[model samples]
Target: MVKKNNASNKSGNFKTNTIYAGDCIEAMNRLPEGSIDLIFADPPYNLQLGGDLHRPDNSRVDGVDDNWDKFSNFRAYDDFTHDWLKSARRVLKHNGSLWVIGSYHNIFRVGSVLQDLGYWLLNDIVWRKSNPMPNFRGTRFTNAHETLIWCARSKDARYTFNYDAMKNMNDGLQMRSDWTLPLCTGDERLKGEDGNKLHPTQKPESLLYRVIMAATKPGDIVLDPFF
Candidate 1:
């Protein structure tokens, strides 16, 4: 479905197929409580790069150095995570769930915040990048994967999970926590006027296809707070 140009934000209501533009917490708070079916969050990872990176050839590396991904400190980052997750909890339907993707730099902190806010722990999936960028300096192993944490609203909430669909994608084998997919590249990656990628951590559409299919049905309202 597509967002209509005239979609309005009426009190305690939200129009379907629309993108609300603002701080995620503020936007979710304004919506009627417990209205969303699924929330797929690609929130700021707070990369906090120490300095510019370079390759063996001394060519500069384009990395996640965006303003949105920078925070003053761990505490500041935790606070930001807490506020949005809390608001996300508020807007989720009782049986609603959320999926959060991040790298080691911030995923652990995000997990802590999620549990502190009472989200029941679910599976933590590993997204293995077939073409991960190498650790240029050889300081560490190739950062070949990212993590996706899926959670239910509460321990008792009955959430959606299409087992057959996921199995089908796996050729009838039971789907596992580790998934192999390529990084976003080529025409699928949104580009700026200068021909550089618009977002540093753009996820591949293939990854999202699995998530949406496994957790939601047709016509379900899905929200991506950080889009």
Candidate 2:
């Protein structure tokens, strides 16, 4: 049996719990087929980033140079991506949906793979960081946002969508294609014992809160494949 940890909001609001660690593909395979309500994947960007990067201002920027982010090449990366996506689709309920986030370096490839795998596209959301890091090298326009693609398991599946909750969270405005939010900062961010960032790419919880509130309902099981 998969062990689940119950997670609560600061106000004690309740919902389906979560699992902290494991190979998500193996974990998903252990689930009964068609069991998950939704999936949110924030896979590696395949940036091929190397070494530590710092700004002239002396602030250190966490580049994604982890071994897990490495791929021999695009073909290898695509193969890995396709394999996991197949697992995700098999575990998702027929009426369930998926959300995947990535930068320009990988989103196009991911979207293409989704099409090949038969996942029906819904909306592609752009998360625009409110305080994006500037291009200190001044080589190109600062990469300011990441893209998230929302899709259903198949064309005819009836996916869960919390329409009202999304509207409220957007402050009554129609939630646009682009979302402007701050990157993880300060105490809300996890840190290592030496005071460095915990995970080089730990996603913002507020971003997740919005995603869950918008895409799922209470009791709906959400699977984070790359969590």
Candidate 3:
């Protein structure tokens, strides 16, 4: 169920496992400081598409052209990134960790802002899509992977990392920086009444499952600011 809260009480209580619908910055600001244990953000990629994209068969490609993904310019996007990252840091516990995923169009900028905000870098993971959509235009190599940045609240913070669980998940071998997963499609993709995808950039649950399992223990609060 989705939870909605306007503000914290005098005792500074925050709700968990509830989805709130609103501007992420404002919603996060309403929470008490140090209330969140972990955060996973999938922000806008600011893809500047010149026109419609089509496959070699002349069928239209469903790209990330949603209005929310649009931005005025690089500076505007950078400012938005900084504001939300700062807000996320404020609500995170001292030992909490954060994960942000993005494509090449904006990962570099996001990484720079994360560093500027003093978020200690842990590892930059690459999610290689097993069944990525082919680049029909053939203008560039098939865009097959996205990047995920993991970081702690600060450099000295002792954060959670389930090393053994990850190893077990990998069949006794240590999990590496590159993860191979499939895109959200088939029955896993949430659809609208018209049979269209409800959310264009919905990530695969398998990806989030591994991330949450590797970084958090049972009953840990995991926040998704961009949900």
Candidate with the greatest lDDT versus the true structure: 3
Report how far residue 209 has shifted in candidate 3, in Å: 0.6
Instruction: Show model 2 residue runs off by greater than 4 Å.
Output: 1-20, 50-52, 57-60
Q: Model 3, stretches more than 4 Å misplaced?
A: 3-12
TM-score of each: 0.94, 0.88, 0.95
Give each model's clash number: 0, 0, 0
lDDT of 1 at 79: 97
Candidate 3, residue 85: the lDDT equals 99
* Whole-structure CA lDDT of model 1: 0.91
lDDT minimum window of 10 residues, candidate 1 = 2-11
- List the candidates ranked by lDDT, beginning with the highest: 3, 1, 2
Candidate 3 residue-pair clash tally: 0
Q: What is the lDDT of residue 90 in candidate 2?
A: 94
Whichever of 1 and 3 has more lDDT, that candidate is 3
For model 3 the local lDDT of residue 63 reads: 90
lDDT of 1 by residue, 1-227 (tens): 76533223445787777777666788888888899999999999888789999999999999988888889899999999999999999999999999999999999999999999999978999999999999998988999999999999999989999999999999999999999999998899999999988888889999999999999988988989887
Deviation (Å) of 149 in candidate 2: 0.4
lDDT of each: 0.91, 0.83, 0.91
RMSD of each: 2.0, 5.5, 1.9
